[model samples]
Target: MKRKNVKLMMLAALFPMLCWAAGEQPISLGTPTGEIQGRVMLPDVERPPVVLIIAGSGPTDMDGNSLLGAVTLKNNSLKLLAEGLARRGIASLRYDKRGIASSAAAGKEEKDLRFDDYVADARGWIELLSEDSRFSGIFVVGHSEGSLIGMLASEGNAKVKGFVSIAGAGHPAYEIIETQMSNQPAEVRQLVKNINDSLRAGKAVNDVPVGLMALYRPSVQPYLMSWYRYDPREVVACLEQPVLLVQGDKDIQVSVGDAEALKAAQPQAELHLIENMNHVLKSCDTVDAGVQQATYTNPDLPVVEELLNVIEKFIKP
Candidate 1:
């Protein structure tokens, strides 16, 4: 449960069958509004453990890529992660959340979207996997915002044997947003704080400043209110299954402190802090802004090896 440096070569030597072939198939789950789309990677083994991969926030797709304006943030983090797990003889399913990519049709109007909708979708996936005979165990791996969603869904679910939180925030969404805005001008920071406080209190602010409108807009306020209600530490503590908390020392978004807080909340949870891993799960040698940006946009980079190692051990141990 403590942080340790893992040698890639050593892990490779210990698990020699790291190149096993895995079959990829498109999977779907029907929701009340529409269908949620996903990909299932099944290794060539009978009754392998299946991990339900939940992606991060925003327009991120199943492959962990999101669109920023006209350009695409093309890191295939989740896709490569699923493939890595499959190669390790573990099955995985990564899905595009509603309002994202192929699942766009399943999205409701912004005002109608609530954080619990995502939790419901995750639970639906759990039910679908529970009835499948190919998978012997069910595990949930959530990254960033998805981490909290996975915790909520996995809590009290008998089918989920384990849970993994990667680059997940330990605090509520509002607090994290406030911390990220710490360097802004005092007035701007105060504006954001006031809005966040209102949202956290389940109240909607009608007049958001022009500069902050995109983030605190009236249409998105309801979803923000729903999201800010849950404290990640509290939720993770409620989970009865084994938990693995993984953080990257190099990650700028979610700090090592957040992972430590999560581990503290759940004393029995295992925690691993991988060296040089970034928010996108790729290894970056420097914290240079440009280099970090490149890691986010590069699709060729594989996820950090230590991450896959820690996860494999947690799932198979």
Candidate 2:
């Protein structure tokens, strides 16, 4: 649960698709919130299933970029995923959440970002595909933090034919945050717990620690509270369509236990655990901490074979 490895992969030497890459045509999808901007990569085949690629947390751009420094990986994981899926005859649509990239217009920006806003946005994408006769099926692929959002959005939506929860958390956001903060000093942990407890109780805390102000600040608390309300395990349990739950063992951001929890909630889900794969969905040995982390920023590395195989089998079979 501490790792985002649940974030995504498995294609080895699949660069052949790169030569045939669709190059991701720019797309502006209309939604209830506003205009959602993203790129659409289609396979050469006809009647392909369309995948809506949802990115993880933070300020991740459409191509899996974080303008906020510290994340230097320009490999374009989402873009590459779209390419790989396209090669396998699956088209994909990946976009920046509300205010990040092309969707940063005044009326459509993140003035008051909430968890449900993303869910609604995802449904908007589903509605778009439902109108397109070319796509016979619509799938929602949620990675890292997007797993929860995808699950909630696709659960009862008739337009979404399948759900893929990658590197998603099975626990509630409060428990996940608490697990992430386990190494913190007792005082800091208690402060976070108190704040979350108050928020869960439908109360807001005005006094906050300077150190944790960024995470629990007044502006972000409402979204955090909304996020904590939706338990991923509960959300997955409600999904009636086929589900593919995939996790990377060496993922530093998400843990295997989260995937197992998801499987427990939905016994029928097809679960695949990839060994030596990090959260970003790259195939490589995790013996060295630096190498493990390097894949996050490695642009040349391709998705592992195992990932592509399962995804293709799930969607085409």
Candidate 3:
């Protein structure tokens, strides 16, 4: 009834400002902060399962690319995944982060965008999908930092039947930072640890080392402090539903060990490793650095069939 009317309005506006080509329709919904923009990609089949595609960190748009079309590493990974899912009769909704691209009006939340804000946005989108009668079930597919966001959003959410984590960080932010700082001087590592400790204890460190001011600056501390409280392993363990953790062997940003850690914490969650797949969801065979890096910019590359196959089975089943 109400859902049908909204769809009719969307359909009637086919000539005004909306484009519904191939079942992709622009959607805007009001939030407590502001309005968030997104695109709902629908399958031709009736009552298809709905999956919310949560994008990763930074100002990443609905397509897994940077906002305002920044030329650097503008890969259409998430966009391709939606198209791939549509081909298999699965529907998805992907959106720009607040203060990013079409969702710019939602910038009111960006300056103070703590990690929980992202989780709230994901939760809002999930509730929106539940309102639509054309969907059979709801699933959350989060990539990179979005994994944490989606996991937190699904806490006690009855509508979210399952979760798919793609290239998500396995350990907490502090541990990951420690691992990445292995090459830095021991003193630098120690300073980071002390700072992280203080923040974890709800104390802000006033004396940030000059060498590391860029990362530990006052402006970034609030968000960092909020994110420090979450441990991926701990969060995954608390989830009672079925979870799918996917990792690519060739990914440079997130390692296979991260996926393994999550699986270890939540033994119930099934883990799948895609051979030769990169972080961008592209299937790159070469071990050569040049070729592997090229995939980040290659928009035409089809998302790995194996990745799509696994997700389709997870949702449809």
Candidate 4:
């Protein structure tokens, strides 16, 4: 018997809901540790090349919701992106990072984790994909912190076709954090400095200002330490495979300079700088901090079609 393509074409419903893109049903990939849940959207015909989408930092869910409340991608980014790919005859896997969503089923807390543990979990996902007959080859798509996760997971995986970084940092994590801190008001800057000093002195930042707890939570120090050891530019420089570096020109949290740094590090990397796009890939009214926060929780906002088009072209069979 011939195998049918698992991809589903989502058109504007023949009439009523035709314009809105249809989403996919959730699925799971069982690993040694626990089951990781994700949604798979494939074209209605044949199975398409698959892409694995990883979420960014903080308490972000699979749908791109951050705990900050000030920011929300109105729509579930991973879910919508996957469904969009399916509409284009492509497939995608968007899973909650360990300690997030369905993966949280394991009861392991993010605060008690290390950076290497994430790399390991990513590797497990890769291994799962390789063993599954459904996918042809996987493209590792990492957003923000996930970009680093993808690079670390792809180190020697021949099954990984390429790597994509969306709003990824170009410098070391702490360096970027320090740069971000410098832009804060004087009081906040001083408090940030104190926390950094405490961390540098090998003391817990618990004694510092309450404002710094976001960065100093006890359960997350090991992961922070592991993340601090890596330089993103160097990692991209050393990658043996093709890379796609996408950044938003209007992103305040991550500057366009970061994108330039990545290009400088890997002259051959494909760079796409979208105008008016923010860190979350949504079109922005302005790049100002205040305006950006206002849209964080508005899931109705749509991502720039340009980004989806570029990604589709890159991952197509």
Which candidate, 1 or 3, has the higher TM-score? 1
Local distance difference test, candidate 1: 0.93
lDDT of 1 at 61: 95
Return the candidate ranking by TM-score, descending. Answer: 1, 3, 2, 4
Candidate 3 wrong stretches, greater than 4 Å = 1-22, 67-70, 108-111, 286-289
Candidate 1 to truth, TM? 0.92
Write one digit per residue (lDDT tens) for candidate 3, span 1-317: 99999999878766432422458988876787789999999877877898999998887888988644446677899999999999999999999987788888887533376878788889999999999877888999999999999899887899999999999999999888888898999898899899989888878888998988878887778888899999999999988778999999988889999999999999999999999898889998865678787788778888899999999988876
TM-score per prediction, in order, is 0.92, 0.89, 0.90, 0.81
lDDT of 4 by residue, 94-147 (tens): 877766657787436666667877777778778777775556778898988888
C-alpha RMSD for every candidate:
10.2, 11.2, 5.1, 7.0
> Candidate 2, which segments miss by more than 4 Å at Cα?
1-23, 106-111, 287-289
For residue 199, give model 4's deviation from the true position in Å. Answer: 5.3
Q: What lDDT does each candidate get?
A: 0.93, 0.82, 0.87, 0.75
lDDT of 1 at 66: 95
* Residue 8, model 2, lDDT: 25
What is candidate 3's CA lDDT for residue 314? 86
Residue-level error in angstroms, candidate 1, position 54? 0.3
Q: Which parts of model 4 are misplaced by more than 4 Å?
A: 1-23, 31-33, 69-74, 183-214
The candidates, ranked best first by lDDT, are 1, 3, 2, 4
Model 3 poorest 10 in a row by lDDT: 13-22
